[model samples]
Target: MGEISIKTEIPGPIARALLERKEKNVPAGPFNTVKTFAAKGEGALLTDVDGNTFIDFAGAIGTLNAGHCPPNVVKALQAQIHAYLHPCFHVMMYEPYIELAETLNRLVPGSHAKKTFFLSSGAEAVENAVKIARKFTGRKGIISFERGFHGRTYMAMSLTSKVRPYKYGFGPFAPETYKWPYPDYYRSGGLDPAELDEALLSSFETFFLNEVSPDDVAAVIMEPVQGEGGFIIPSKGFVQGVKKLCEQHGILFIADEIQTGFGRTGKMFAVEHFEVVPDIMTMSKSIAAGLPLSAVTGRAEIMDSAGIGEIGGTYGGSPLGCVAAIEVIQMIQNDGLLEQALKIGEAFQACFDVLSSRFGQIGQIRSLGAMCAIEFVQDKTGKRPNQPIVQEILRNAHQRGLVIMSAGLYGNVVRLLVPLVISDSQLDEGLGVLEDVIIQCCQNQQ
Candidate 1:
């Protein structure tokens, strides 16, 4: 009766055949949330090969803010394919690339003279942003926060904070990258938010003395809302404080809005929430409505620091990606997705708040607009991460036709990256499935 329709087991006959084929052909390195291939997707609904319909709450790991295969995006891609797929921007130089650059320059915060360049993925953007920062500032060191998830390239990996899955066995990372403490207020061991902010901000001076000098630091790359770090939202003061430190020390503040940009956080970009403009911003996940496009937008002077042919790839800013991104920007602006994001966040918070009251294991419910997450703990007092419970909940939700994913270092946080365009009924139905699963799982645990 609801949006979910489970006609067969999760990995049905067709899916099982494909999975066996996938195992033979594909490497095991790539991770998958649900063990099924998608046949079709629209808005917030995805149907697998098994004929099971799921309410998509993961949104392709937050890449489908405009929802899967948006008609406008598909139409744009179709037209672009007929005209030309990739003229190779370096060789021919396309109009779509220039147009997308102009649009991002106008939209991505700050009224200053700005420029934008595109890449194929968020990691590529991060690598280039670091290169630009180093070139512009004439510095070698970069500082990233604890539990941050930058891309997996050598330079981006060095800047990333996670070790087990992202960094382990792939060491000999790029040098001069350092990690700083990012505030996790929920797990702050009774420290006041203001006190924690002040401590971390002040510790920068000590860090400069102890580890690396501030003058040698090229930039401090940060996620406006730490995506892989459990959707951790830093206080406005904390963000401003870091920016102030960057300005004082002549270090660029690079905002990694890859997961928080394009109406995901109710704002055009998550940096807008803090009212602090970043020197450079890396955006990707939801930027192109699922096209493999990422962008680095910043002040013209800083962006121009890289010499001709210094920072670019063969497929960087492909014509298809450029056109898709252009349409995506238009959709975000004109389709009421921004307002819809706020509504989704409100709905998620209301649902989670009720569940939290009933379940003490719900440690923290946090969001910046639709970028919402519910952290599960062992108990109310101890606040130990409950990874087992999260795993059970996700498994149960999947069986019942809700697609969700777990985040956080301990994998105890259930993150909701539901599409902004999801209908009210679909949203409720998805939440209902999640709620029922959580109740059942918790009761069983007890």
Candidate 2:
């Protein structure tokens, strides 16, 4: 526990002062996992204003896969800053922007001739991808999966799945956006995984007949591994089946890789795990290592459907974000973070396998590479979501100096988005803290 030093309580003297100022100034709409303020960060560790150090498992909500302030990214950002900052891609184009675009074009799944453009956020990328899809296909409808999260922007929110926090009281959302069911095999109540996949895939044709026609749909947007939807992993057959349906219907398949991209899932992109290639992809979160950069990459012909000057922003492709992203990609490729992701997943699974056997509250522990989650239930037989226990575990874990957060539509899942670069010892320590906390919390419920 050397890396985790809880010298003072979570919101110790200094943090309490900061929190007072924050409560007075900042809006409650913006949520925070850790109640304290960050003083500094390195790799997978974050130091708070009260002099407490924590093993960060949230990874800034999947935005710091390269870890906080990676040396190469920081060095590159410093050099770019010394030279110049944003000249605004809309007015004066820069070379780093083109360079990063080329890198994504080659790296982001699909060997076909592709084109890439920049945006300031994941929502912007989704918005532009939707625009490109509509312009290319000249259709009006879009389809997203149940329990999946896109973003907070109007169109992205329309595609998102969760309510209460994300979508409650926010309507009326954009029109023509539809929801499709993504598979959750653990909760399928004894249904065979293959059967579930087949049923969901075959139901698409019936859906078209009952709802919107296939020809009227412009695109189907899906998260390769539903991140905000409780880290739900669908069968490869299901994903490929969706792609096949799109191919047959002349609708574009848009993979939203915002939280699952950049080595979060063993591979550079999660779509590779399913062996399905998307026509268009929206990427962000770890793209620039939290520099607020996103990309929309697609088939050259389709991306070009939007005439020049139709898609762009004032700070779309800032030089700093581009340089940081370039270094981030190179860092992932050269530094062996992909393999690290697999190792983290293995460690988490191994640790939780025993815990799940002992604790009936643990409904499931699942992972695809480093994107891992533990679903809490009332009991083994019922499998009713135990959201209260999840809340207790989160609070205890935070007090114990392990920074983590909860997810799932019902808010009963504890998701781990640990930075891929975390050392084995740090990972073990963090998991140990989480394990002890879960045991105590579950026992209390009993």
Candidate 3:
């Protein structure tokens, strides 16, 4: 079956009309990647209202690792709808909620006695994790990495590093949040990787002396792979060092796996790759196949710090989301999605590695499993970010039936989060469109 079927000029007629309606009603704050509205989504493909099908490389911003509307997830949701909708965990307990909690407790990267709780969004999970960390350690300060992004809520935003889009006017954020440098070997300015790591690690001690006392810090939250901060990946040594620093102090280590969890990195959790078990972990994005579910899994004792009524929400761990998440975990485990992620990463590297040599703008091609990105620069020597090239490439790719997105602090990175369920042929086709668009755009600049 043909994967990409572009019948109209992107928005076409029907989509343009809908776009008019959206522009009138929907506020500009909520961003849209694809100009056209989705009529249907299946596997890794999305069909627009105008009947244009796009090979989705964005995967709903890493929320569909099991693919769009996966059969198992949909089946589970259908069955759940018949049973009941919400019987919120707070009002009346549901079996699926307990089942999901048990599943996450068993699966998340820790052998210790762990507890899990649910929320409606990634921000909520992060907020609750911070609360738990503070309650458990009785500390006021929380630390996150420089390029890391947690969420948009107050506490998460305070921890988040990106200031422009996420935290521009939203001032007077949650207090006692600090930022530390995460290693970016690609941008280390000719310094050795180990040297850069040591410098960054050493800065933490300096930070404790000058900025805030380590004893006052409750937790150091990190995205195993920085998602919104351009899919930046840190070394295992760096991650271990941060964990050790947290241990040196009384601070807990919180692995923010919102974008890197559930077999996205060829592992159940990204912390597995680092060989570090976090005291607390925040998870969302792909948890329930776009069911708007997030979770905070942690050491049982730490989680128990908050009394019964202090935690949880009205819509936390809804029955449908829980059932869907259980199915998602099963699908990733049983359906070879972890290996599939590896295959996608290998294919992406093979396709982009050659381009990196051909074009001076291609600064680096990076991936940890299917989470891949190509950082563009003006030249190899200076490595000035070439954001225009990325914008052009994205524009051209969208016009040609490929849905891709950009990332990075400078917005010069083309990040690919293709669904693991994408067929080899569909993957090849999407890559072809992207490759052609890149060549055309880069060649034009050259």
Which ranges in model 2 have alpha carbons more than 4 Å from their true place? Answer: none
User: How well does candidate 3 score on lDDT at residue 276?
Assistant: 99
Give the per-residue lDDT digits (tens) of candidate 1, residues 1-446.
78889999888899999999999999999998998889999989999988899999999999999999999989999999999888888889989999999999999888899999889999999999999999999999999999999988999999888897999999899999999999999878889999999999999889999999999999999999999889999999999999999999999999999999999999999999999999999999898888888999999999999999999989999888888888888888899999999999999999889889888788989998999999999888999999999999988899899999999989999999999989999999998899899989888877
RMSD per candidate (Å) reads: 0.8, 0.7, 0.8
TM-score of 1: 0.99
Instruction: Report the Cα lDDT for candidate 2.
Output: 0.94
Q: What is the C-alpha lDDT of each candidate?
A: 0.93, 0.94, 0.92
Given candidate 1, what's the lDDT at residue 12?
86
Order of candidate numbers by lDDT, starting with the best: 2, 1, 3
* Model 1 stretches with alpha carbons more than 4 Å out: none
Candidate 1, 248: how far from true, in Å? Answer: 0.2
The candidate that wins on lDDT is 2
- Model 3, 74-158: lDDT tens per residue? 9889998998898778888988888899999999887899999999999999999999999999998999988889898898899
lDDT of candidate 2 over 1-446, digit per residue (tens): 26999999878999999999999999999998888999999999999988899999999999999999999999999999999898898887889999999999999888799999999999999999999999999999999999989999999999999987988999999999999999999988789999999989989889999999999999999999998889999989999999999999999999999999999999999999999999999999999988989999999999999998999998898899999999999999999999999999999999999999998999999999999999999998998999999899999999999999999989999999999999989999999999999999999988
List of clashing residue pairs for candidate 1: none
Per-residue error at 107 for model 3, in Å?
0.7
Worst 10-residue lDDT window for candidate 1 reads: 437-446
